[model samples]
Target: MDKNIVFLLNFKINKASSSRKRGSRLIQNLDSRLRGNDKRVKVKKRKKFVLLSLVFNYILFVIYRLSYAAKYLIN
Candidate 1:
């Protein structure tokens, strides 16, 4: 009877350990996926900022060219 009890206890311990390992692996996978998504969001924001800056610069250049043209015409 004592031997049977020991075997059952050992089996329970192994089962618990295996479950813990699986849970940790699941957490690690979720963390990596979240990090990947965050990086993509950051990249998208950076691209949007660059595009807006280019548009603003182009508008400023056009305005400067228009002012120069008006000045030449007045002369």
Candidate 2:
């Protein structure tokens, strides 16, 4: 199981001369950006999951065939 975890960090650096209060506007902007990033991550996760499952199924199939052959040889 390969998990690709993405960490999004938003840093706000304020200047000494700038105003102290940014109000709700800044919060709204950050919220929208975070939501967009979340959607992107979800899509990537879905793709990875599909690929992982395919590989797992292939490995299981190979093992099944090998065991079947071994049993046949023993008989």
Q: Worst 10-residue stretch by lDDT in candidate 1?
A: 26-35
lDDT of 1 by residue, 1-75 (tens): 368755755565565566887656555554555456655677899999999999999999999999999999999
lDDT of 1: 0.73
* lDDT for predicted candidate 2 compared with the true structure: 0.63
Candidate 1 TM-score over all chains jointly:
0.54
**Model 1 clash tally?**
0
lDDT of 1 at 53: 100
TM-score (all chains, Cα) for each model: 0.54, 0.53
Give candidate 2's TM-score.
Answer: 0.53
lDDT of 2 at 41: 75
Best by lDDT: 1
